[model samples]
Target: MSLAELLALVNDLSQSDKLSLFKLLAAQIPDAELQVIFSASEYPVWSPYDATEAANILMQMIEDDKEASTRA
Candidate 1:
């Protein structure tokens, strides 16, 4: 059967059966593959909180543009 047909059948399974099937499939994956799929790495996330320097620079640029437009 095609993957779509298999997925459709799997969709009909109960929650417990789905979990069992997932465990069975996950067990067949190699250790390296599993590690890559579930990586243990910290990723940096950017936040605008306490970004005063960047906000000041952006405000200066806007002011400069306004001044230049008035001069033109």
Candidate 2:
């Protein structure tokens, strides 16, 4: 599905469903460490388990989306 289509669908999912989906994505890929890109002073701890783990999860999600779309 297109990004616009995906966004529309994602917007309709329940909070619990979203959380469950996130946990499932995390289980598939090990958590990735992320460093703050703006400053060099201090790097904040980042993980797929963190609140924004959606960043990492989205990356995997996009790849999966591509494959699924291709198959369709």
Candidate 3:
């Protein structure tokens, strides 16, 4: 059957059946192909911990703004 027809049939499947279909399809794929499809990479994440410099800069900006407002 065409992919569109197969997808339509798959759409009608229950959640458990869909999960089974996913496992079956994944089993057919080679390890290398799966690795390529799901590449591992590190991503930088921002944390508030050890952010004293940023906090100081923000406080300075606030102070500058307050000083400017008082002068106005």
**Evaluated with TM-score, which candidate comes out highest?**
3
The candidates, ranked best first by lDDT, are 1, 3, 2
Instruction: Score each candidate by Cα lDDT.
Output: 0.97, 0.77, 0.96
The TM-scores, one per candidate, come to 0.56, 0.38, 0.60
Compared with the true structure, what per-residue lDDT tens digits does model 3 show for residues 1-72?
899999999999999999999999989999999898789786899999999999999999999999999999
Clashing pairs in 3: none
Which portions of model 1 miss their true places by more than 4 Å? 40-42, 47-72
Root-mean-square deviation of each candidate, in angstroms?
4.1, 23.5, 2.8
Better of 1 and 3 by TM-score: 3
Question: Cα miss at 37, model 3 (Å)?
Answer: 4.1
Regions of candidate 3 where Cα sits further than 4 Å from its true position: 37-41
Poorest stretch of ten by lDDT in candidate 3: 34-43
Number of clashes recorded per candidate: 0, 0, 0
Error of 2 at 44 (Å): 8.9
lDDT agreement of model 3 with the native: 0.96
